[model samples]
Target: MKIYDWFDGPYPARVRIALAEKGLLSRIEFVPVNLWTGEHKKPAFLAINYSGTLPVLELDDGTLIAECTAITQYLDVLDGNPLLTGRTPAEKGIIHMMTKRAEIEFLDAVSTYFHHATPGLGPDVELYQNREWGERMRDKAVRGMHYFNGVLANRPFVAGNEFSMADIAVLGGMIFASLVKLPVPDECEALRAWHARMLERSSVQEWRAMVERGQGVKTLPITADLK
Candidate 1:
């Protein structure tokens, strides 16, 4: 399998971490798409994914899967283990709900603020920006942090006891927030504790190592494990 993505991108980190968790990192090849250069928005890349998003999965048969959730779901079931997604119907429903909520209330909101309010990928990639709307979304993202803090105070994971894609989605939000210098409120102790635990995960450690190794490379095909 080939994954087209930018190294160190928060959204791409989600799927990369999932791949590591599934022990499929050694089997895959990663193709770099430079977000700073606006490669993803270009016509050539847009043909691969209509949404022109990062972290697209391309299979051996040339099947293309876009969107982080879809790719994670596919990978989760590949070994019939479904560890990241969920096995039970109720688990699936709750995980999906919390994941969507994370995206809407946090991750996507931070992305909007980055693209609109901040100089995200520079002037070339950001065709248009809405500063006012972006500021509003920034506020929304902070509110989202507080909301997730409350949720984590009650449960071990975002959805429930088990760590699911919902946790990853929120992790993506936290990653994005950090990149944008949006600090989590000091009062959100539960969220901070949960993030600390997440940072200790082997999958996340692998992802961080990959990011460190990937720095300074431009348009290179980086192996998942760099081995």
Candidate 2:
């Protein structure tokens, strides 16, 4: 089976980390879509993903898979890990729900703050940039963080005690937020502890090094295990 991978940003990095964990990184063709050059928005790329986003996966059968969550599910199933997603119907439901929460809360926050606050954070510095969009995104993120802190304060994982894709989704953005000086609130001790554990994962350690080695992030408030 062939995997046409397009990635160069935090969102796609989530898939990279996931694929790496499943030992699929070396099995697939790495097609680097330069988001910095607006390659993803080009006509050729848009034909694959009309939304013009990176991390679109083309399966061996010529099926296009879009959206981070959908791609995660597909890869997890194909990997036969069963545990990466969930072993039961109930588990899948909660995992998906929590993943959605993370996407809306932390992921969206990182996207807004990076594009608006960081210089040359997005594809272009002069065009397709929103000066105030970063602040708006941060505001949303701050509020979301408060809500997440409450939900996370009492749980070990986003969906109960089992580590799910939700954790990966949230961690991908939170790691970037840390890289860019958007501190994770100290009050969210649960989340911080979870982040620490995530750092120990082989997949995360690998990608952390890759992201830091590349010029991908603006800052790294704390160095996660650079293995």
Candidate 3:
């Protein structure tokens, strides 16, 4: 099928990682949506996903999946054993629960501080753009990270030992957190180790090169330590 994939952002990167893990990289076409130029807000893209977000997957028959979680789930179905999302009903439930935890904790926090607290991104979503709300969200995310770090301490991956959709979700957020210079406590060895491992992965390395270059000199690198 024709996957109108957006590989310019963290959301797409997670999908890219999942695709790579399943060995489905060559099965789809990659498309880059310029968020810096406000292309996501443009009419043409909004026509597909009214929510106006990237990492949108479009099927050959014109089917469009908007959210990152949905696209990852769809991609999971393409694998031989369906490991990303889960194999059984209970596993699916846990994976979804943990994935939501990652989003609300790390992902939401970075978005609050980056867009609402920082500038030049344009207030496309006013939900957390204001300073007051942004700061509050910052705290929420920090606490969320701590909780996640503790949860990760005894495990190699999220969702109990095995790498699941939860790992992709959390890794995507950590990359965003690192990009925005979010304070990941040095004491959180698990977080650091996990990020370093992810960075070494071929999928992450490939997508990151594109992200850093595509964002241009203007975006630059917020955290020089990311590499």
Candidate 4:
């Protein structure tokens, strides 16, 4: 399988973490898609995914899978007991619900803020932006952190006791949140604690090591304005 990904991007990082967790890191080829250069919007890349998204998975038979959650769903079930996406029907539903929430309330919100409120990928990529809308979505991401914190207060993970894709999605969102300097609410102790624990996971640690080795830069460089 060929995984088209951007090393520095959070969405691809989600799939990378999942692959690591599944112990399938060596099973696929990682193709770097340089988002900073506006390569993703080019015609060749668009042919792979019309949405011009990163971290796409191409199966051996030439089947392409787009979207982070969809790729997670496929990779999670590839082997073993399928712990990431859940094994049972009810578990699946809850996991999917939380995953979507993480995407909408957290990751997507931060992305909107980055692209709209800030210069984002610069004028080359972000053709349109709404500062007001971006600010509103940034607030939503903070609220998401609080909502997840409340949920974590009741359970160990986002979906349940087990570490599921929802947890990974939240972690990915947090990483993005950090990149944009959207600090997690200080009072969200439960969420902060959970994030700490997530950092200790082998998959996360491995990804960190890779980043240190120059496989990717986990977060974008902070400019003077952000600081």
Model 4 has a clash total of 0
Query: Which numbered prediction scores highest in TM-score against the true structure?
Result: 1
**Model 2 agreement with the true structure over 40-140: per-residue lDDT tens digits:** 66666677677877676767677878887888888888846665678889999898888888878778777867776776535453356665887888877
Off by over 4 Å in 1: 215-227
- The predicted structure with the larger TM-score, 3 or 4, is 4
Q: Which candidate is the best by lDDT?
A: 1
Q: How do all the candidates rank in terms of lDDT, highest first?
A: 1, 4, 3, 2
Task: Quote each prediction's TM-score.
Answer: 0.94, 0.82, 0.85, 0.93
What are the root-mean-square deviations of the candidates from the true structure over C-alphas? 3.9, 7.3, 7.0, 6.4
The C-alpha lDDT values of all candidates are 0.90, 0.70, 0.72, 0.86
* Model 1, global lDDT: 0.90
Q: How close is candidate 2 to the true structure, as a TM-score?
A: 0.82
- Over 63-89, each residue of candidate 3 has an lDDT whose tens digit, in order, gives 777677898888778655787888889
Q: Write the number of the candidate with greater TM-score, choosing between 1 and 2.
A: 1
- Model 2, residue 7: displacement in angstroms? 5.8
After superposition, which runs of candidate 2 have C-alpha atoms over 4 Å from their true positions?
A: 1-8, 120-133, 212-227
